[model samples]
Target chain A: MSTSQAPLIPAPGDTRRRPLVVMRSVSKMFSSGTLALSDMSLTVEGGEFVSLLGPSGCGKSTALRIIAGLGDVSTGTIDWPSSRINSKGLPEGDISFVFQEPTLMPWQTVFGNVYLPLKLRGVSKSAAREEIMNTLATVGLADFADAYPRELSGGMKMRVSIARALVTKPKLLLMDEPFAALDEITRQKLNDDVLRLWRETGITVIFVTHSVFESAYLSNRIVVMKARPGRVHADFPLKTSMSRDAHYRTSEDYRQACEKVSNMLIDAIGGEEH
Target chain B: MSDHASAFVPPKTGFFARNRDTLLRTLIPICVVIFLVLLWQFIITVNSIPQYILPGPLAVANSLYNDWGTLSPALWVTTQITMQALALALIGGVGIAIFLVQSKWIETAFYPITVILQVTPIVAIAPLILIYAPTTQVALLICAFLVAFFPILSNMVQGLKSVDHNLLNLYDLYGASRWQTLLYLKLPSSLPYFMTGLRIGGGLALIAAVVAEFAAGSAGAGSGLAFRLLESQYRLNIPRLFAALVLLSLLGVVIFAITSFISWFFLHRWHESSLKREN
Candidate 1:
């Protein structure tokens, strides 16, 4: 189940070029005393797309929540180098989240959903209209600003969720299997769209998914996790340097990378059962 | 090949069939009302029932037109009492709902009393209320409010409590204040339920007002339609009694229609209830 040891903690005094997020010796124990994560640690570098790949009950989502500050670490600390840029000692707001469900406000229009983070910051719609439109355009939903979520297809709704996440122009984006519920075709299409957006904006992405092929296709590094007090079991660097496109799917290198991740996942699961 | 060709052909529907579908879907209830009226007219005419005992529809209509001089003023008084009671209920019920949501202890102490009011028969309490209250109008208003207030309070409380846990967490993450959460999330989420309670409460309040008037006889120098009904019945002026009953039913229908329309107007854009009807 284990691979070569990769130091989860970032080197101290190298904070200037260190990963944007650093989680060290983190653990989460629920009120029921179930240990979801035990001494789990990970560092996500700037402008990198990393996938937390694991089976069910692997606490991958919990790890992402700890990074997002949505969940508290019971034992250790999470350090964000980006927070040093803010001088007021206030917690920074340079992170966004996209959940598994679209989670759009049912009462709000698409445009209203995208404008929510800005609105929360007391930014007027008139002041941020250009940026809102530009964000919607990037998601190819410029014409759907007035549409309600009920009127949208599953894929379209996920697109709106992505647009809302990106509208704030955050440096870090945390997504929890945002396309897991969509059809395979739609999921693949969204995967391409998200990678394109990532490349263009240089925003660091921490995506959680159980799909080996998806991890290989979309991530620079796949952080493989094992269950039952979940912790990192492998950190595999995907070596397919081919540009992510339709041709990449047909390349021999893509299949080999996917196969490698799949074998690691099987071994991790097999070890857990014993 | 022949079967496949036939599969794509559309069937032709007759004019009557199309029209019948429309009428069955839309106008059948209206037709039933007309049919019932005609049947009632036939029964009264053929039975040779005396006008004082059983007035024909035409006779009641004539009496209603002739007595408009008196009937209109009584209608105005009833309408005023009903509206004032409803308005008071709206303000008090919503204020109480807000209090209840803020403090669980207040809800625990007061919610049972609201349930008692809802389940207790209004007819049993009206006379006691009338005897104790300073004025008959006040007594009637109190009765109406008693009947009307609980629905709005109960509905709004449920609505406020039904807010999504995730949404609340999102607000917390954004550092939104309690007031902001209530204003932006709780209030908007509760509107459809509140409106539903109002519509139901409006009709119930009218019934309470009329019944209270019936039980109290007449208040002050001004009498409402209930008094006229009593006056007609005692004198055996059956046509006029029938006329008053018809007017009362019409008033009930109008109140229900207007409240429903207002609910629809506000909620038509986002709510499923209105959307289902539109489709």
Candidate 2:
């Protein structure tokens, strides 16, 4: 909002679907005197995969956290315009967050970790058993329900984290560099899984990552952000359709998209350096 | 077997091969203990040490068997005091730890006093406690409790504070209430640290119980092994003294073993400290 940078790809405007949540001129200054974000405005529409791409120290994560209601904005407001708002006034179960780390409770089994969101809402284990199993199945971890977090591989643990996030069938999913710790092969597989899940569930995803290729591969819209009091520098949609598959990953169009996004990311960081 | 030969099936090993580690772990300690006892006996015999000064292992064992009726009651008394102090320490320590961890201000306000209580010698406090307490037993219990409480409180406070920041954020994102967060996340995550405290506190409780009784100098039929130890020394019954000392040592070991078992039972499933390594 501060920069007023127009979307490089023309905004679809009134023809676009309803915006699920809109952040208007939001700024966050932590008590530690770190200006994590300044005038970061974003509008995530229903059923769109939006990736917030940036360099290190960028406040993409801070912005995501604030939107998820895990952190309070020092200034401005986030409005859930059309999604169902809970009594807490914070969309409650309608939104789920996947952290950078798997963040599973080592003491809990995969099923228990996945059951946490419902459990917090007072749902009994027996009542939520089938739903928990189904979410685990969706993440390809149906047989690992009774396995503890310590027993899982990095990829598997991240799958459990995804299962936990999706267990509630949330309308909005916020992920903060969810696969940055993973190997390249695993990250690619998970990227495919996440795209498939988003396609299937029609959940609005705001994915945060520094990886240009990943953002290009997964997002319908990419918002390249600049660091040092982070704010949006460029917002654009892919010129191609959303039906991405393994073949599409190696396609000429996808390669061009990745190149464009990569150059934009470089410019975003380079501009800040000057 | 023939059909799967090309598939690289593992060879079946003998029982000893399978259990070499277990055998070594148990047997080495037993062998060392036996060797030490024999050396102690040999030293006493060679020196022709008087029973009043340094009783032989056999003499001490004889006294242990002969004075079982008297020694057993004293052992029971000491055991009861140690256990009661440990149990009370656990409850009070955990309760206060939870309350203190609620805020940084609360922890800063109260944690130093617990450290002070811990550092102040229980032996020095026992005399003052004995004069004011309702009975010698109560004074001993207080001293033991004071000694045992700090390790648990400090460890539990640390454990509660050390919860993964991301996990806490996840809990907040889920809108988990304070109680739900504490019960489901904080408590389970703190358990390994709590177990560490329990093991340390268990041994300290026994030491404090004995030291407090010694400092209080309470003597009677109801007195603990500490009193029996003092009485035996005063009467020049060195064998009985050695026997009582042995029982105390055994009690300490038993407390350690029980605490370790409890720690293992809870943590072996997931905690890194307790997990079995492949090697």
Candidate 3:
């Protein structure tokens, strides 16, 4: 944690890549009179793994929902400048969302659950079989294609969920605290799986999490958020060139990054009291 | 994922141990029925009751064998009415439920009418239908259909409305059309509830068919078992009356069994209500 051993990473002012999504002064107010977000602005590049790190009441989830077109922005515009818009005026198959829960249909088999997004778009089962199997294999669930959601463990169900999300090969993947319910071991394992998937597929990811260690480990960039009319408190890039595996987990750079992000998170929460 | 499946594999067991619950379920019911029949016969013999006042089980069995030629046609009539009513109820109830769930305005306007029909007893309305219908058969069919329709409609409506909110959002995110959502999501989610409705409606349909025939009391070669019961009472043929009563009870049991099998068939794979316990 000493200054002499601090990792030589890029500072927060870097913005050289083309933005895939741009949100300008976005504010969301719920019908229950809760201002979940206020004047939030963010720009995500095409292949960056960005984490929205915040506490429970922060509007990180609200921001993700707006980006996924699941919720309406009360007072701003979200522009997908680099993606194609479907007839519904949203990025149709260009974006995929993973909720906090598995949110799978309990009656469906793993194959069927992973095939849902494609099936909804009028793709036949036989036509999508290969891509579905390949995605399942990527998540290490190729052997569980016939198992029902009720038969699988919690982590396996989440793997099916991730498979469903990645089946479409979307440009932007939005994960809303998808690993929060998992135990420590399963969560760490999924964290590694998601990082590998992100790197291999080159999909821009906006992962929402409250865990500083998680944000520090998986993200190329981290957006720290504050609660009570949630807005961005800090936007910084974590430019570690080390491969994120067990070795990096025990390295001094990873420790220094987590310590830095946790202090910023504490400062963000501490500022809300005044 | 690799080690998780090992714990869930059920341990091997002998055939008897595996089927012990089912064997007990079937065996206990048969024993209780035999005991009740023997008890009934013993009471009759011990009291020296006349056959005219109380026929013994053997006398009733004899009547069943002797009167099969007469009772068979009536049984066919009752069976046809019950089945036709059930099939019609299944179609109409599910159709109306779909129509009502399409919009809040339609549901508000039409759901109350279904409720009213359900609350009015079929017996109270049978005479009115019998007078208005083209024939007595039509009247009986209408009675049974009315009795069976409500449960299916109510349960189907609830099932359709109970779709998970998260699943609905996922459907929307995928740009699924209205029909696609209903076909792929809502209908499948409603299967367990629909099976429950079918089981309840099956029994009610049989009861309504018999009770409606009793209200009609129209006698002829085509009359159901209910009419035979009344005729035997009038003619003082107690053994024949007991035979018809036994056949009616057996018909109820058969209907129950068939409906239960159907419920189990559709839901056994995934539904909690039908899955086997670990023990």
**Which candidate achieves the best DockQ against the true structure?**
2
TM-score result, candidate 2? 0.94
**Candidate 1 backbone collisions, by pair:** none
In order, what fnat does every candidate score? 0.13, 0.97, 0.55
The parts of candidate 2 lying over 4 Å away from their true place are A1-16, A86-88, B1-17
Runs off by more than 4 Å, candidate 3:
A1-16, B1-24
Docking tier of model 2: it is: high
- Native-to-model Cα distance after best TM-score fit, residue A95 in candidate 1, in Å: 1.7
Best by TM-score: 2
Evaluate residue A245 in candidate 3 and report its C-alpha lDDT on the 0 to 100 scale: 82
lDDT of 3 by residue, A1-274 (tens): 2342222222244332468899999999999999999999999877788999998899999999899898889998999887788865598699999999999987889999999999998899999999999999999999999988988999999999999999999989999999999999999999999988976777889999999999999998999999998999999988665778878899998999999999999999998965
Q: Provide C-alpha RMSD values for all models, in order.
A: 5.1, 4.6, 5.3
Docking class of 3: medium
Report the lDDT tens digits of candidate 1 across residue range B180-245.
Answer: 788878888888889988988898888888888988877434778888888889889888888888
Q: Indicate the worst ten consecutive residues by lDDT in candidate 1 chain A.
A: A1-10
Error of 1 at A190 (Å): 0.7
**lDDT, candidate 1, A36-58, per-residue tens:** 99998888777778899999999
* Model 1 DockQ, alpha carbons vs. true complex: 0.36
